[model samples]
Target chain A: MIKRGYWDIDDILADEEPIMVQVTKTIKGAGFLNPESGELDLNEHTRFTIPLWLAENMATRELAKIELPKIFGESYLNILEADPRIISLKDRSNYFFEVATKLNDFLQDGKFITPLQKVFVARFVHLYNEITHNSDPKIIKKLTELERDIYEKGMKTTREFFDWRERKFDIIRSAQHVVNNAKRFKLK
Target chain B: MENEITLPESEFFAENTKITIIPNFKHAGFQILSGFYGPLRPSVAIEVPLWLGVFLKRQQKCRIIPPAWMDLQVLKDKFEEERKKEEFSELDFYYMEVSSLLLAHAKEDIPNHVLICRLIQDLQDLRTSKIRNSLQKITVENLYANFKDIASIELQAIRRLLPATYDSIDYMRKTENND
Candidate 1:
């Protein structure tokens, strides 16, 4: 999901998501990665949890094979498939969709691709219809980071329309950053 | 790709649309960047840009004539057509902006402006539901959607969301595991 060396903060943060992989070949001088065990080298056939970025690299080189996380397992996917609109995806993972996208690439089965599209489309449709009246904080709490970005963008358009309807058009406004920056400079 | 038009920008462009206005002041040609309009005479109705009409109307110097589509009977018939058809009924590209501007600045000038305002709002609500219905059709296998006959101002409402959603969908469908 992340392009290594790209200037994407979200990608960088998403790359930090820990993933599980089984070592096919022992890696030397890497025992420090697993802080729980005081070992000198990573042993062969040991199941290890590593960040997404490293796991992909190791798996591609035949040094390890990735195992789908519990969230990507059949039971969780079945829950997502049953009703996508009501689930609190944020509780499961902040970068749920982003990590899923990356995971789909490793899975040549095209496993996560269909469910990703299905979940996004179903939740997106529900968000579109009811977002204008989304005053309740509970609705936003259910959204993951990607979904939150979409919600905020859609909400901005609705707010602009409502402001225009209320005839608040003639006022000159300050940029959002300017307003926020001003507060920091204020003396206590 | 044509740049996405924002709400205020769309309203600003709609201000350039011409409307008929009856002035109470006599004046020779008033020149503006857009061109020469003018020779204003008392009680004489003449066509002018909506912005100029609203400006003069605010100063109590002229009376604005509501656009033809604002008539109650006309709107009622149009609403009926909108209900019967799956496609959006053709409306003036600037209908949303024009009606909002007229209703805000020259309320007294438009006959039965209250009923006209309500009708316009109801029509907008109907069209919005139609948009939501079409958006549900978007899926990974069938991404191409034919959104035809939508007006400029109405298009502005969903401009940001639609394209951004499509882009996200493209991102999700990334195939090359290499790059």
Candidate 2:
């Protein structure tokens, strides 16, 4: 809980900077506002959209020789036959190969959103490599590069988004706190 | 109208979702969700739709395994735990994962899905964290408010999922710009 008395202020005083937590909060609060349009920011809402991308990456990575005993007992192919998206990708080699190329290009030249989407891509590749370590060393080696880049981009984008949101929400909450305190002061 | 409305089936709990063993047995389907799996066994893996995948991932939280802000060392530990346990048969894992994933992403029933996920995780972790449970309750209430934000017609789905809170209340319809 990092508790201390006022006398311990000397320890923090030598740090030579006002604790920056409040400033970060203010920035995050303001982040919910759009700079160009003066409208409510919508990008902050998109964080919830990551699951589908992660799932897609998982499905494609582990494609072929996949049998779903739950969906259809030993007839996994029959279920995929019913669902189009499962069979859309040709095969594992082609799917991962194409994803690697696409991810490399995006990392090299894509916008902020591209990197954000690739976070799940990296996780997928890593999981596959972990599971198939003994059998598919070659595929794991190839995906390692893609996984590293995608992971880095995902982390950066996630940090920026949260930092921006924190700054915006902090100010909004603080102002409300101030108003309540002021009303109490008047009452006193 | 009472007779006509078809109920949405949870794919996760359906009888159709089954598993089978080959060569040794002719007719065996795995029913892991309703059935039990012993600790340290492999479970089947199910393939799910894209939308569902996104939904389940968000619901996963920090317990023994790391949450979104999990440390590398903790993550490594989780990887080891995953390696050691082999409860979910390949097929059961696929179906369960996919169904849970899809249920997580189903926007109309999101609150319910989120509730189930959090509750289930809590159950698994043997956690009694009030903050976690309260946050879920708050989300469910917010989901109720958001349901009212949409057109009244869409409210029916929300009502079905949240019958106790929503059944008695009537939504205030905002005036459309066209009106």
Query: Worst 10-residue stretch by lDDT in candidate 1 chain B?
Result: B170-179
lDDT of 2 by residue, A94-136 (tens): 2222232232232232222222223322333333223322233
Q: Write the per-residue lDDT of candidate 2 for residues B52-132, one digit (tens) a residue.
A: 224333443101111221223433444345345432111121232333333433334333445545433432232112212
True contacts kept of each: 0.42, 0.00
Off by over 4 Å in 2: A1-188, B1-13, B18-20, B25-161, B172-179
Q: How displaced is residue B46 in candidate 2, in Å?
A: 15
